[model samples]
Target: MSRGRGWAADDGSAVAEFVMVNGLLVILTLSVIQLGLVLFIRNTVVDAAAEGARFGALADNSATDGIARSVDLITTALGPGYATNVTASTGSYLGHPALTITVQTPLPLIGLIGLDNGLEVSGHAAIESLN
Candidate 1:
Protein backbone atom coordinates (compact mmCIF):
# COMPACT_ATOMS: atom_id res chain seq x y z
CA MET A 1 0.00 0.00 0.00
CA SER A 2 1.30 3.50 -0.93
CA ARG A 3 1.14 6.20 1.70
CA GLY A 4 -1.21 9.08 0.79
CA ARG A 5 0.56 12.20 -0.62
CA GLY A 6 -1.40 14.67 1.58
CA TRP A 7 -0.39 13.03 4.86
CA ALA A 8 3.13 13.31 6.25
CA ALA A 9 4.83 13.49 9.64
CA ASP A 10 3.86 16.86 11.17
CA ASP A 11 7.14 18.60 11.98
CA GLY A 12 8.95 21.93 11.74
CA SER A 13 7.48 23.86 8.73
CA ALA A 14 7.82 26.99 6.56
CA VAL A 15 5.90 29.24 8.92
CA ALA A 16 8.46 28.85 11.68
CA GLU A 17 11.36 29.81 9.39
CA PHE A 18 9.49 32.84 8.13
CA VAL A 19 8.74 34.07 11.60
CA MET A 20 12.34 33.78 12.71
CA VAL A 21 13.80 35.45 9.64
CA ASN A 22 11.26 38.27 9.65
CA GLY A 23 11.82 39.05 13.29
CA LEU A 24 15.60 39.22 12.75
CA LEU A 25 15.19 41.50 9.78
CA VAL A 26 12.99 43.91 11.73
CA ILE A 27 15.44 44.04 14.61
CA LEU A 28 18.36 44.72 12.27
CA THR A 29 16.51 47.53 10.53
CA LEU A 30 15.61 49.27 13.75
CA SER A 31 19.16 48.94 15.00
CA VAL A 32 20.52 50.62 11.90
CA ILE A 33 18.05 53.50 12.19
CA GLN A 34 18.86 54.01 15.85
CA LEU A 35 22.56 54.15 15.06
CA GLY A 36 21.97 56.77 12.42
CA LEU A 37 19.99 58.96 14.82
CA VAL A 38 22.66 58.73 17.48
CA LEU A 39 25.31 59.77 15.00
CA PHE A 40 23.29 62.77 13.89
CA ILE A 41 22.69 63.93 17.42
CA ARG A 42 26.37 63.59 18.29
CA ASN A 43 27.50 65.60 15.30
CA THR A 44 24.97 68.35 15.90
CA VAL A 45 25.85 68.67 19.58
CA VAL A 46 29.58 68.76 18.94
CA ASP A 47 29.29 71.39 16.26
CA ALA A 48 27.14 73.53 18.50
CA ALA A 49 29.64 73.27 21.30
CA ALA A 50 32.44 74.42 19.04
CA GLU A 51 30.42 77.35 17.83
CA GLY A 52 29.56 78.36 21.37
CA ALA A 53 33.15 78.27 22.46
CA ARG A 54 34.19 80.44 19.58
CA PHE A 55 31.45 82.94 20.29
CA GLY A 56 32.41 83.17 23.94
CA ALA A 57 36.05 83.61 23.08
CA LEU A 58 35.43 86.71 21.00
CA ALA A 59 36.37 90.15 22.35
CA ASP A 60 32.80 91.43 22.56
CA ASN A 61 31.33 88.25 24.08
CA SER A 62 31.47 86.40 27.36
CA ALA A 63 31.18 82.81 28.47
CA THR A 64 27.47 83.34 28.89
CA ASP A 65 27.19 84.28 25.23
CA GLY A 66 28.82 81.02 24.21
CA ILE A 67 26.51 79.10 26.50
CA ALA A 68 23.48 80.77 25.00
CA ARG A 69 24.60 80.19 21.45
CA SER A 70 25.31 76.55 22.11
CA VAL A 71 21.96 76.09 23.80
CA ASP A 72 20.13 77.79 20.98
CA LEU A 73 21.84 75.74 18.34
CA ILE A 74 21.12 72.53 20.15
CA THR A 75 17.52 73.48 20.72
CA THR A 76 17.01 74.32 17.09
CA ALA A 77 18.74 71.23 15.80
CA LEU A 78 17.43 68.69 18.30
CA GLY A 79 14.96 70.06 20.85
CA PRO A 80 14.62 72.25 23.90
CA GLY A 81 15.33 69.37 26.20
CA TYR A 82 18.76 68.90 24.66
CA ALA A 83 19.66 72.54 25.18
CA THR A 84 19.28 72.71 28.94
CA ASN A 85 22.68 71.43 29.93
CA VAL A 86 25.02 73.59 27.94
CA THR A 87 27.62 75.69 29.76
CA ALA A 88 30.64 77.77 28.85
CA SER A 89 33.79 78.57 30.78
CA THR A 90 37.06 80.45 30.34
CA GLY A 91 40.56 79.18 31.02
CA SER A 92 44.07 79.07 29.66
CA TYR A 93 45.49 76.72 27.10
CA LEU A 94 49.05 76.76 25.79
CA GLY A 95 49.66 79.66 28.15
CA HIS A 96 46.99 81.70 26.36
CA PRO A 97 43.34 82.34 27.19
CA ALA A 98 40.66 80.01 25.89
CA LEU A 99 36.94 79.30 26.06
CA THR A 100 35.18 75.99 26.49
CA ILE A 101 31.65 74.77 26.01
CA THR A 102 30.28 71.69 27.67
CA VAL A 103 27.10 69.90 26.68
CA GLN A 104 25.16 67.01 28.15
CA THR A 105 22.37 65.49 26.12
CA PRO A 106 20.26 62.43 26.48
CA LEU A 107 21.81 59.29 25.15
CA PRO A 108 19.46 57.35 22.91
CA LEU A 109 18.91 53.75 23.81
CA ILE A 110 15.46 52.35 22.99
CA GLY A 111 13.99 55.61 21.77
CA LEU A 112 14.92 58.70 23.83
CA ILE A 113 15.76 56.81 27.01
CA GLY A 114 19.25 56.42 28.27
CA LEU A 115 21.40 56.97 31.36
CA ASP A 116 21.37 60.29 33.17
CA ASN A 117 24.09 62.44 31.64
CA GLY A 118 24.47 59.66 29.10
CA LEU A 119 26.26 61.80 26.52
CA GLU A 120 28.73 64.53 27.35
CA VAL A 121 30.73 66.58 24.83
CA SER A 122 32.85 69.70 24.97
CA GLY A 123 34.60 72.16 22.66
CA HIS A 124 37.30 74.76 23.07
CA ALA A 125 38.42 77.91 21.26
CA ALA A 126 41.27 80.33 21.81
CA ILE A 127 40.35 83.68 23.27
CA GLU A 128 40.11 86.21 20.48
CA SER A 129 41.57 89.56 21.63
CA LEU A 130 39.48 89.86 24.73
CA ASN A 131 38.93 93.53 25.37
Candidate 2:
Protein backbone atom coordinates (compact mmCIF):
# COMPACT_ATOMS: atom_id res chain seq x y z
CA MET A 1 0.00 0.00 0.00
CA SER A 2 1.26 3.49 -0.89
CA ARG A 3 -0.11 7.01 -0.23
CA GLY A 4 0.43 10.26 -2.21
CA ARG A 5 3.87 11.85 -2.08
CA GLY A 6 2.68 14.95 -0.19
CA TRP A 7 -0.08 13.15 1.71
CA ALA A 8 0.89 10.06 3.63
CA ALA A 9 -2.66 9.31 4.82
CA ASP A 10 -2.15 12.02 7.46
CA ASP A 11 -1.90 15.23 5.50
CA GLY A 12 -4.98 17.47 5.82
CA SER A 13 -3.43 20.88 6.40
CA ALA A 14 -5.46 23.38 4.39
CA VAL A 15 -5.14 26.17 6.94
CA ALA A 16 -2.20 27.79 5.21
CA GLU A 17 -3.80 27.67 1.79
CA PHE A 18 -7.09 29.01 3.12
CA VAL A 19 -5.40 31.82 4.98
CA MET A 20 -3.46 32.93 1.89
CA VAL A 21 -6.53 32.83 -0.32
CA ASN A 22 -8.73 34.61 2.19
CA GLY A 23 -6.12 37.22 2.88
CA LEU A 24 -5.89 38.01 -0.80
CA LEU A 25 -9.67 38.25 -1.00
CA VAL A 26 -9.79 40.57 1.98
CA ILE A 27 -7.16 42.81 0.49
CA LEU A 28 -8.99 42.95 -2.80
CA THR A 29 -12.25 43.80 -1.05
CA LEU A 30 -10.60 46.56 0.92
CA SER A 31 -9.07 47.97 -2.23
CA VAL A 32 -12.42 48.07 -3.96
CA ILE A 33 -14.04 49.78 -0.99
CA GLN A 34 -11.30 52.35 -0.87
CA LEU A 35 -11.59 53.04 -4.59
CA GLY A 36 -15.36 53.43 -4.29
CA LEU A 37 -14.99 55.89 -1.47
CA VAL A 38 -12.53 57.95 -3.46
CA LEU A 39 -14.75 57.98 -6.50
CA PHE A 40 -17.74 59.00 -4.36
CA ILE A 41 -15.84 61.86 -2.80
CA ARG A 42 -14.60 63.00 -6.19
CA ASN A 43 -18.06 63.00 -7.68
CA THR A 44 -19.54 64.79 -4.71
CA VAL A 45 -16.92 67.49 -4.87
CA VAL A 46 -17.45 67.88 -8.59
CA ASP A 47 -21.15 68.33 -8.06
CA ALA A 48 -20.58 70.85 -5.33
CA ALA A 49 -18.16 72.80 -7.49
CA ALA A 50 -20.59 72.82 -10.34
CA GLU A 51 -23.38 74.08 -8.14
CA GLY A 52 -21.20 76.74 -6.60
CA ALA A 53 -19.90 77.86 -9.98
CA ARG A 54 -23.43 78.09 -11.26
CA PHE A 55 -24.41 80.30 -8.39
CA GLY A 56 -21.31 82.41 -8.73
CA ALA A 57 -22.02 83.05 -12.39
CA LEU A 58 -25.25 84.74 -11.54
CA ALA A 59 -25.56 88.45 -12.22
CA ASP A 60 -25.84 89.42 -8.55
CA ASN A 61 -22.99 87.21 -7.42
CA SER A 62 -20.70 88.56 -4.71
CA ALA A 63 -17.50 87.28 -3.20
CA THR A 64 -19.25 86.41 0.06
CA ASP A 65 -22.11 84.85 -1.82
CA GLY A 66 -19.71 82.82 -3.90
CA ILE A 67 -17.94 81.39 -0.87
CA ALA A 68 -21.20 80.78 0.98
CA ARG A 69 -22.74 79.12 -2.05
CA SER A 70 -19.71 76.95 -2.55
CA VAL A 71 -19.70 75.84 1.08
CA ASP A 72 -23.42 75.28 1.12
CA LEU A 73 -23.38 73.30 -2.09
CA ILE A 74 -20.43 71.22 -0.96
CA THR A 75 -22.00 70.53 2.44
CA THR A 76 -25.35 69.70 0.91
CA ALA A 77 -23.86 67.52 -1.79
CA LEU A 78 -21.34 65.65 0.32
CA GLY A 79 -23.08 65.66 3.70
CA PRO A 80 -19.96 66.24 5.84
CA GLY A 81 -16.18 66.17 5.85
CA TYR A 82 -16.24 67.87 2.47
CA ALA A 83 -14.67 71.31 2.73
CA THR A 84 -14.61 74.24 0.39
CA ASN A 85 -10.97 75.14 0.31
CA VAL A 86 -10.82 78.11 -2.04
CA THR A 87 -13.23 80.09 -4.09
CA ALA A 88 -11.66 82.61 -6.45
CA SER A 89 -12.55 84.76 -9.37
CA THR A 90 -11.18 83.14 -12.50
CA GLY A 91 -11.89 86.31 -14.43
CA SER A 92 -12.84 85.54 -18.00
CA TYR A 93 -11.82 82.36 -19.63
CA LEU A 94 -13.60 82.78 -22.94
CA GLY A 95 -14.87 86.34 -23.04
CA HIS A 96 -17.01 85.86 -19.96
CA PRO A 97 -16.47 86.51 -16.25
CA ALA A 98 -15.57 83.19 -14.66
CA LEU A 99 -15.68 82.00 -11.05
CA THR A 100 -13.81 79.07 -9.60
CA ILE A 101 -14.83 76.70 -6.84
CA THR A 102 -12.40 74.38 -5.14
CA VAL A 103 -13.31 71.54 -2.84
CA GLN A 104 -11.22 69.21 -0.69
CA THR A 105 -11.64 66.13 1.48
CA PRO A 106 -9.44 63.94 3.63
CA LEU A 107 -8.88 60.35 2.77
CA PRO A 108 -9.42 57.43 5.08
CA LEU A 109 -6.05 55.87 4.45
CA ILE A 110 -2.64 57.20 3.54
CA GLY A 111 0.52 55.35 2.48
CA LEU A 112 -1.22 52.14 3.48
CA ILE A 113 -3.00 52.07 0.09
CA GLY A 114 -5.19 55.12 -0.34
CA LEU A 115 -5.13 58.84 -0.93
CA ASP A 116 -3.37 61.11 1.52
CA ASN A 117 -4.99 64.51 1.87
CA GLY A 118 -5.46 67.92 0.28
CA LEU A 119 -7.18 66.44 -2.72
CA GLU A 120 -8.65 69.51 -4.31
CA VAL A 121 -11.01 69.70 -7.29
CA SER A 122 -12.20 72.82 -9.00
CA GLY A 123 -14.93 73.94 -11.34
CA HIS A 124 -15.43 77.13 -13.26
CA ALA A 125 -18.35 78.83 -14.94
CA ALA A 126 -19.03 82.05 -16.77
CA ILE A 127 -20.86 84.88 -15.06
CA GLU A 128 -23.95 86.36 -16.56
CA SER A 129 -23.45 89.70 -14.84
CA LEU A 130 -26.53 91.88 -15.55
CA ASN A 131 -24.61 95.05 -14.72
TM-scores, one per candidate: 0.86, 0.77
Model 1: number of backbone collisions: 0
- Candidate 2 residue-wise lDDT at 19: 88
lDDT of candidate 2 over 32-111, digit per residue (tens): 98778777877877777777787777787765576677787667766545663655666766776688776666655632
Please give the TM-score that candidate 2 achieves against the real structure.
0.77
**What does each candidate score in C-alpha RMSD?**
3.1, 3.4
Using lDDT as the measure, the top candidate is 1
Q: Could you tally the backbone clashes for each prediction?
A: 0, 0
> Lowest summed-lDDT stretch of 10 residues in model 1?
2-11
The 10 consecutive residues of candidate 2 with the worst lDDT sum are: 108-117
The global C-alpha lDDT for each of the candidates, from Candidate 1 onward, is 0.88, 0.70
